[model samples]
Target: MAGKRKTKASKAKQDDLAKPSKWRLQHGAFSGPIRAADPETGTPVQHRRAVDTLGMMLASGSITAQMHEAGEIFRGLFRAACFDSMSTSQLLRIPGSRVDTLSTMQIEARRRVAAALDLLGGHESPCGSCAWFVVGLEFSVREWSMRQGWAGRTVHGPVGQGILVGTLGTLAMHFGLTPRAKAA
Candidate 1:
């Protein structure tokens, strides 16, 4: 007898939960209370079915237009990504700033590559944070190389390379220097 009562109570609760709330439909449709009776003639104004509203929208071409707009946006994004990749590739090539002999140039290149990696992978570069240090080193190296004429030993393009190397080394050294106040 007790088991039967428990089963009946559970069944009643399940049925209540399964029933859709009338308040949801009423409040969702309009601000005021909904009525089947027409205000002017007291005749019934038949409420259109939910499926009919969807069918009408589809028939009117609005849904298709929305879909077309969505497709266009996706296509535009895809093309834009392709263009960005191609430009980035060109910027990283043989004569680009990254390949320059200046240490600052290398640092700048690293920064750009890190940014591109982040854009592609949604992560920051570890080396990016230390780029300033690299700049200082490059500057110092270039200065030392120039003072020493290190390029003279090289077989080809020694003069130009020594200038490049020395300049970068000097810049790197300048970056690392801590300024001391001038004596009066």
Candidate 2:
């Protein structure tokens, strides 16, 4: 009878182990609460699903796909920033409007990327040369992706390059490939 009771207790323990834990069922893998606002802007986050999806793609190693998707995201942001009444014809008629718009976006992207790299804790060059280096690295990646048959295009090629530079640079910094900037 004692041996039988021990077997029964072991079986009960096995059953408990087979059942998924409550936390696992609730959060699956990620456990932290999602942020409601952008850390920089303090505004309610927009395109939450798209941003999360991009993160998932990056984790999954779908680089080229994410690159194309990033272009689409930039285009969406550009459109969102435009006046609601602005039409495609009106936008096209402005002299250098497209170039100006794309340049603005690229500059903004580069700035944001640089800020992100700083947040990742690394020694970056004070002359802002590291950001440009990141831009070149990102541009090379874009060109390579194009060669590999990525079809999407941004209005200004540098827009995607700037974003890529910031991202890859941050990764490099995180891995200690890029040294942290020294205090003056």
**The candidate that achieves the highest TM-score relative to the unseen native structure:** 2
Please list the residue runs of candidate 2 whose C-alpha ends up more than 4 Å from where it truly belongs after superposition: 1-48, 51-54, 57-87, 91-184
Which residue pairs come into collision in candidate 2? Answer: 122-180, 123-179, 123-180, 123-181, 124-181
Question: Where does candidate 2 have its weakest 10-residue lDDT segment?
Answer: 126-135
Q: Distance (Å) between predicted and true CA of 78, model 2? A: 9.3
Note the Cα lDDT for every prediction shown.
Answer: 0.33, 0.41
Give the alpha carbon lDDT tens digit for every residue of 1-184 in model 2.
4564444445433334434456656633442444478889899753323133234445667444434343334334334434222344454476554633545665565555445445544323311332233232222344433432223532234444444545544444443444556210
Clashes of 1: 17
TM-score for each of the candidates: 0.16, 0.20
